[model samples]
Target chain A: MATFDLNDEGVVVIVGSGAGGGTVANELAQKGIKSVVLEAGPRFDSSDMVNDEWGAFQKLSWLDKRYSAGGWHGAVNHQNLPAWIVKGYGGSTVHWAGVALRFKEYEFKTRSTYGEIADANIEDWPVSLEEMTPYYEKAEIKMGVTGKTTGMPHLPWNNGFRVLAEGCRRTGRTDYDSGPMAINSIERDGRPACQQIGFCMQGCAIGAKWSTMVTELPQAEDTEYCEIRTGAMALKVEHDDSGKVTGVLYADAEGNQQLQKARVVCVAGNSIESPRLLLNSASAMFPDGLANSSGQVGKNYMVHTTGGVYAAMPEPVHMFRGTSVAGIVGDDVYHDPSRGFSGGFYLEFLSLGLPFMAAFMEPGNTGWGKSVAQGLEQYDHMSGVWVLGEDLAQDQNGVTLHDSEVDQYGLAVPVVAKTPHINDVNMTNYMFETSAQIYEAVGATDVYELPAYPASHNMGTNRMHAEASKGVVNAFGQSHDIANLFVSDGSQFTSSGACNPTLTIVALAIRQAEYIAQEMNAQNI
Target chain B: MNGRLSIDVYQAIADGVSAGADADEANATALKAGLGEVVAQAQALFGSSYVDIPDDDAREGILRTFQNEGFFQGVRWAAYFGIYNNPDVWLKFGYQGSSVEHGDYIDRGFSDITFVPEGPTLEERMAQVKG
Candidate 1:
């Protein structure tokens, strides 16, 4: 309701408030570095989270404003359509099912092992897992991630992990391990322990999940130095004659356009809108777009192509009893990598299909009178597992601004042309067979494999590289072309690991925040 | 004799044809006696605007005047009876009728939704249609 201004100490302005922006904001505020965050969604209190499905669906979820479009390639056309996207404080993390796992060490380098891909600009990352391990540790402690490491010989383990491991061992597949998750298993950080009501996709009513609404942004709010302006949609970044970022221009809640000056500007709009902002910031000096001299601003996107397997157990699993992701198995992750595939995959037994969504996918539903009743009867007996594998980097699957269409705010919408490589199919098939075996071992009847696709956990848009000619950002998540501009979301990922991207995004955001703070001190700005 | 010319023309010729007159020669003589004019009058009134025939609703309807009199229904019934005579029409509609639930759109990779072979005859389908 009020017009805003930058804090007096020339605060660093971050453009988003999800895991990446929230993580950096909390770290910056703790270090006594002045920072301000501009978020497009309103701030919601955890107390506002209601229990009923109807109330939760209407009040909390991001189902209304999401858009989709197909992408175009060098000489090919791609389909761009609309989809249900999230808005508000947490961004996609608001509706995320809360699966957390660290990226494997090998995920940082794809080109180094698999060789150059055809018609792709695939490359390795500047930072490795060892460099991010400490930050990952800090994020685990902060977010209260549950589960023991399962794939390798020795990793962290928890109760859920132990049960999955025992189940796997009983079936002669000794590779079942505990999965790491962001939900609060115990009463850590003043958040309540998990009651596991299984409605996390609709927003955790009990604050059991570590969403930004429960985690970092609140800490940022406590620090008076960080000012959070909600409903402030950043249009583009303004630059001075010297190619340095001057300030950002954004539209306010009242549809009034305003500019806020800051010493540095950080864009953390996740993978989709982050590149959209940069591509929109075309100027005389940077005609191809800001910080995009290498022509790699919105290239190298990955989604870890996923499919689901559903089986009917003898008894009702009541999968809605706990968090969405229960456990993971990587027995087939690296077992036969010498078979010529460049990557492995992980499968997690998870809760899927609410009443409405399940009814939509019901196999025997005739959409007539008595048939609808029969479909609802099978809801309790169904349980499913989601298989996520590494999508090798290919330049062909990239995002570009469309020539014709624009958003409601008169900004060009990004047309994403994504086509996963042949290796994606190989990894998906391998994971599918493993899932079928697990179902058979656990004595499941009536197993069905869901369709596969390049889904929405999009990563690696503003990728980080050691050389400026190759990547848009440096290892610290700072733009190599611009001194002060930084990116800390999944956009900075070099390669998508065989795991969910949220936990790793949090780790890298903290790692980058620390780097930014030290850089400010050194410059005495 | 005032405004009309009455010909004892077709009656005399038709009577002769019935009494062993050459039938083809009689037809040719009738055609020569202005039969084209009679057909031209019929075409001028009916042929040009068939699709726009008026119905009970103030707007032009899809069916012609004669079809609106129930001729189309008779033709449909004929087609349905034709299919009823041929049992293979059931398989033509892809209706195996084995565990096939009504309105089930998705097949579990087991069966496809296709035409029922030797299915309902056009006459039977038209009879089933309610007014």
Candidate 2:
């Protein structure tokens, strides 16, 4: 509820108040530093949250004009909407299933561990897992993730999860759990425990899920040092002649342009928009883009290699009766070159409403075949797993500004070009076969393989590298060229590890906040 | 209500398209208004009498003419949303609608398992994995 003046040059300006920007705002505010968070979407509290899937999607999804290219199925299927990210106050966190996971040590060093994958531009994270452990713990504690940090027990197994666990056991796979979820199994912080409404992705209507809209943004405002300006779309990061970011030029709620001066600018507008903003901010001093001295600003875009495997059991599984993604089998989430792929994946339990199942069970606009209809008819008897794995970053697969197309904001629409690598194809095949086998070992009558939905875990557009020539940002998410500019979102990911990116994004933001505070106190900028 | 496709026509299309779906179960008024614009555009593109074309094959042919158009996608999505979320449709498909508002079935049926187990319980499996 706090408000800051547009001319306030002393505040840190954080764009996109989601997992990253919202966390950064709260962390900085806790450090006695003032910040102004500019969220491009409207503010919606729990009152606005709904259990209806399509309704929540309309309220939360970023439906901005974007183009998709490259050989990825998304290009042909979801041509205009390549990513299923949110645009509102909490960003995608509003719609997240809250599977909080940390990248393994080997995952942090993908480039070093999985050496010389052809056509992949993989790189090791400048900061190792060892460096991120403390921050990850801090994030787990802060987000109330169900694990050792919090004494809260993991959620009880729903029927859907029971089916998945049974299948895993039959297949000789181990290492499955109901959590590490950010959703509350018991009430903690100021939020209530999850009612297991089975609508976690549709913006937890009861505030059981940790979202910046209900958590960080409010806590930051309680400090009276943070001002969250909703419906403010950041157009460009304005910089001075000396290459220091001065402020952000944004279009306000009424479509009027305004410049909010800042001592520091943190871009956390998810992966696509974070890089798109930089690409759009091309100036004489930095003609290529802001923080593009290495020409890696919008390169190496990665959404995890993903697909879905669902099986129709003879009995009523009622997969949609509990949490959407509470169970995960992590035995396959390790790197073993013997598997014919460099990286590995996790088979996480996932359930979709009948409408979404009908739409996304197959690709293209309309999934009207007999197989698709029968699959929808058997919704109650189905249990599924979403295959989430490490997606190798390729230099050619990235976000680029379209030449001719313009959005309603008069900016060139971002063209998200992505094509699955040979490794991705091989890995997906293995996952599909393994999943089908597991279900078959259990009592599955029919199995369905669904292609990847639009990019859910968008990462690696402004990646971190120890060497300035290899990446756009440094180990601390600070731009090498502009000391005061930072990429505090999933866009700063070096590699797409075989886990969900929210926990990592939050941990990195917490770490980045400490660095930014220390640097500002020392007047390093 | 968008002045192109009437509610009756939209309901008829919905009933005709969806197998075992009742026309009254769908949100006919809303779908008619929402999908009316798209239906108008389809009519404009294919022919003015596209909606009134009585023959099922001729209507299918007309709809196919605008397959790549946003109007067609809209009409299809409208039918999907209307038919899928209907309570009667859910009953027919054996889908127990939204459980969150009335508390989860955690205590009621979440732990009920009738199928024979191929391996140990999840806890035992976890213990074995840990070892």
Candidate 3:
């Protein structure tokens, strides 16, 4: 790994080394552009990855103190855990279940296509699917995503996914398959194929799944132009008088504050931390917060309306024997207003071990009680689908800094509140009914509808829009207020599509890198 | 860990709570604080110590009061991890842990995994339960 000097004012400082920041850094490095990547957590390679659920969770999950508020399940049952993101070098991509799907055309045109959704902060993305398709193709090939375009076969299904696939088949749904997964189906990209290890959420030990730790970060490092400094948590983005972000204030591994100078700053710290950093970076020039003139920096935060739908079959499913989410049911992924919701959802394969199933069945209740214990008694017979749906963005549902309460870092503790819109309710109810139908069609003994767990798909805080007043960034994730500043992550999403946002985030970062390099060449501030 | 329960049941709960104590100190503290709350609440509700309450339903009612508290959820998390993480409990639930070393469950035990073409009717399942 290369190291850049603290006073190196020529480097582009990219915060949060996840899919976005990592891809951007690597892409920029490929262009011979220098960058310093500041990652909040320690860098754990595949060798350090643990397979045990609890062990891996402690090792990878961002368990720092955060408060949840509002009428959602996270607030009621998981008040202290609003979202579950990784704080490591690769970020959530390390823990992600490699289910990659590109955004539909209408998904990018939410406001135009959905047409005046009530009480929703709906807006069309400035970039269309047409513009993003080429980048998505690049991302798919780069990440070894399994699909038609990538020319890579999808990974094999586990018994858990088999049950769901069989159910989908019995229900007359033909759009079901084993992939679009970024996890390798064959030995490619210097990484081995997935061995169906079941614990995909835990870091893949063989590096079969695409993570920046193995892919982008290493490529970036090999370029000798990108320095990924792990265990450096970004506190605030510092800017000069002209409102151009020039450096980053971060806590080093030893808990000492250090400022690394930069020519440009890209905030990719997910939806929560990205906005939280901006809100904390408030100055006299931008009194409310940096690039927050629209008052939307921390607003419209979305973790897709999600839940675990498990069915108890009469036979042992042994759902935890293969890749966690390679299988998906896409029959309900399109819009149909007759279904009483403007948007739709996808049912993807999910398997929770006994401990996790016991934890999330009804999170706030006692686990030893017969209610959940009985559910666990049939753990071997269970097959589940994780519903990722279109959760409407409401301005009130977002991340806000607590005035008095502070974290161990002495920064204000972020309070992430999410109130589900009625659209979410309607869509969720329909999702439940249709998902239950898929399971029941194949003779499921019982269908268990579990509420939302801590979100891994957190998105849409510093969104993109053409008008500066409507959003924080442009189509390219460039800050509307600050020319040199950018939001290069899922935080730049204008709408929360039903699909997983990693592919889009990676695609956006890849495209953003080109734009950034062009601006550097053009000598634009 | 509460003494209000009978010795046999109390031992099981105690074993679980003891196992749970190692999960995280925060969870253990929450559980201990909650037990303290339960003791006081039991006295207030029944004019007797929790152990001397002598009725399971009354004791359950007292415990239900703290269900929404952090301690309650913490205890739930601890107990589940404690109880479920136990290999014996896992065996009872027919769960196999950590599949990577076992050739990734590809060929072994991934085949002939049955799903009933048509499941047992409610009356049929009820008959099995009754039996």
Candidate 4:
């Protein structure tokens, strides 16, 4: 509730209050640094969440004007929606199923380990997994991840996960179980344990799941060091003569523009809007975009090589009875060039409800047939898994401001383009084959290899690297060109590992906050 | 429409096409503005008015041409969700909608799987792998 004046340049202005921005706000507030968090959507507490999938999607999803253009499945089937992230205060964290996974060591060092995957523009992360361990542990602890670090037991298996686990067992794959999740197994942080109510994607109605809405934002507000302005859509970041970001020009709730001055500006507007805002903020000093000296601001976009594999079992599975993402099968979550692909994938339990499956099936997006109806007829008998494979960075695949189109805010609309690499294609095929084998091994009546859905795990638009010449931001997510500006979201990802990204985004935000505080202490920016 | 239950017809077509609420806005706009042109195009393709199409197969063929059209996609998704998200349709799919009110499904068969065997615990699996 503490509000800062427009001329208060002492406070940092953080855009997009999701895992990254919200985490940075809380972490900085805890360090006694003040920040003004601007969320483009209205804030919602856990009680305001919806259990209906369509209802929550209508309420929380990012419905801004953007276009998808590429050869990928998303372009053909879902041309308007390349990335399906949330827009509310908690961002995608509100909608995320509590799958808290850490990147493997090799995942960070993909360039060295995978070594020349033809067209893949892979690079080693500036911060290695060894350096990130403590931060990862901190993030896990902060989110109350149910794993070895927290001493909280993994969530119990549901009928959907049991089907996949049995299939994994039958297929000789072992690293399968109800894995480390951020949802409460036993009430520890005042939030009740997950009651197995199942609508995790529809924003966790019971607050058992860790969302910045229920955790970071409220905590940051309580510290009296943060002022959160909901429905404040950032139009552009204005900079001083020295190329230092001085303030952000954003449209307030009433659609009138206001300038909130900043000591430092952090862009955590996920991948699309983060890059789009930077591009929109282009000036006479930085024509290409703010902090785009290397032309890497909106380059190398990667939405984890993803797909869904659902099987129609003989018996009823009732996949929607528990947590949405039930468990993970991580046998494939390692590097193996011998498999004709550079990186690996994980088969996580996924159970799409009747409405979703029917819709996404698109009747094959090819023919209007009875086949889809037959599949939906077996809704209770369905069990599924989502494939999260490592997607390589391609400079050709990124976000670009559309040539002539402007959105509701009158800013140029962002056009996200993706072209999967040969490695991605080969790896996806391997995923389908293996997933189909697993399902068929456990007596699946029919297996469906669905095309990729609108990506929820988007990364690498304002990527991190060791050197300024190679990337936009440094390891701390501080922009190389604009010292006072930072990228504190999955947008700064150097590479996309084959896992969920919220934990890593949180860990990086915490780490970046520490760096920002230290730099402030030293009067660096 | 094709001798199937009225609900099954929507499932056969598609749903979730209008995932974003903005898409719904655009779709609603297109539904009003583009319907006339779509009918005209359908008429030209079918050699008759859209409602006067003689056969389902011919009607489907004309529909295929406008598959990517804004009006077509909008109307289809709107119609599909109308039926599928309906409370009456929930019984057909055995969907237990919004269980938080009755409490979480922890005891109400969230873990119940009759066909699949109960697997070993995570500890047991780790121990076995170590061995």
Q: Give the candidate number with the greatest DockQ.
A: 4
Off by over 4 Å in 4: A363-367, B1-75, B119-131
RMSD of each: 20.2, 6.4, 6.9, 4.7
Query: What is the C-alpha lDDT profile of model 4 across A453-505, one tens digit per residue?
Result: 88899899999999898899999999999899999999999889999899999
Q: Score the docking of each candidate (DockQ).
A: 0.01, 0.21, 0.23, 0.34
lDDT of 1 at A256: 80
Q: What TM-score does model 3 achieve against the real structure?
A: 0.91
Q: What lDDT would candidate 1 get against the real structure?
A: 0.63
Model 3, A86: alpha-carbon shift in Å? 0.4
- Candidate 2 residue pairs in backbone clash: A197-B100
- Per-candidate TM-scores read 0.72, 0.89, 0.91, 0.90
Overall local distance difference test of candidate 4: 0.87
Model 3 CA deviation exceeding 4 Å by range: A366-368, B1-77, B116-131
Tens digit of per-residue lDDT, candidate 3, span A160-266: 77788888888889887777899987789799988877788988988999998899999999987999999999998999987889899999999999999999999
lDDT of each residue in A1-525, candidate 2, tens digit only: 578888989999999999999999999999989999999999888878776777778888999999889998888999898999998989999989999999999999998898988899999999998999999999998998876677667777777888888888878887888888998877899899877778888888788889988999999999979999999999999998888999999999999999999999999999999999999999999999999999999999999888999999988877787789969899998899889888889889998877678778887864653456667778878889999899999988999999998887889999999999999998999999988988888889999999999988999999999999999999999998899999999999999999999999999999999999999989996
Report the error of model 3 at residue A79, Å. 1.5
Q: Give the range of the ten consecutive residues with the poorest summed lDDT in model 1 chain A.
A: A150-159
